[model samples]
Target: MILFLGTKSGKEETKLLAGISCPYCKQTNTLSAITSPTYFHLFWISLFKVSTNHFVECSHCKRAYYKNEFTPEMRQALGID
Candidate 1:
């Protein structure tokens, strides 16, 4: 018997931030935050979530910000500790 295994990313959810400006575009209320949960799978069945990815995008500039690049202001806007 053969088995298949891999990691898959789940659906992403977006949340708009208020009273926040994109550092790249300097636009207000254009920051959309999204998070993806990566799951370990076996035979196409998700076994458990390995990690979650956090990111923010600027609508105007189309720039992507990852967790490592997240600023204090951005973290506050996303309500992330």
Candidate 2:
């Protein structure tokens, strides 16, 4: 996941999670923070007394984007290179 940490210079820290996109299907996939649900409860409880976290699964291609990285088209449109 992309951690947004503010810097002393008043700039945002951009942490990108790199991965390969499927050529034919053009699907962007990412790794999950946790896979199994067996330790899910314990993992969550370690931090907060009550917390809520969501793991998203793409319905179309079944890919995960924890950081929600942008696509080439999006980058070009936003004038980001």
Candidate 3:
């Protein structure tokens, strides 16, 4: 996954833009890494052009997100700004 660091509300941390999180578990408090050629290729294809995609993970819930689900602070992290 493509990783970036950004500051949110005056706090800095790392996050994934196209990472996957387990949806079944929401409070496991564990985070996992995911990477695949198709996923990476899609992200690059969209990023290289004028498209923006955001992927988020919930360590506590293992849930993932895309697009509108991303926070404004995360936009800066993934170079969306």
Candidate 4:
């Protein structure tokens, strides 16, 4: 028998960034911060978290920004350190 083992993405939590504006949309208070975790899985069951990802998106333009792409202002606003 063969067992399946891999990593899978977990639930994402979203928070509205009240003071942040979307770079693409240029709309204030339209940015939302999304956070999710990647888990190691065995036989389709999640074992442990491997990593966490952070992203920012615009509610109006639907633009997404990755962690690495986040600006200092964005990082400070999101409390990401």
Top model by lDDT, which number? Answer: 4
Among all candidates shown, the one with the greatest TM-score: 1
Candidate 4 all-Cα RMSD: 1.6
Candidate 1 regions exceeding 4 Å error are none
Task: Write model 4 residue lDDT over 6-60, tens digit each, in one string.
Answer: 9999999998888777777789998889999999999999999999999998889
Question: How well does each candidate superpose onto the true structure, as a TM-score?
Answer: 0.88, 0.21, 0.35, 0.83
All models: lDDT?
A: 0.90, 0.35, 0.43, 0.91
By TM-score rank, best first, the candidates go 1, 4, 3, 2
Q: Which of the two, 2 or 4, has more lDDT?
A: 4
For candidate 3, write residues 1-78 as lDDT tens digits.
Answer: 775533222213444434333445633324432222122224223222222234556666657656466556445545
Tally clashing residue pairs in candidate 1: 0
Error of 2 at 23 (Å): 14
**For model 3, which pairs clash?**
26-60, 26-61
| Span of 10 residues, lowest total lDDT, candidate 4 | 17-26
Whole-model lDDT, model 3: 0.43
lDDT of 2 by residue, 1-81 (tens): 654332121212232223534333565543222222222223224322232222333434656433245455334333445
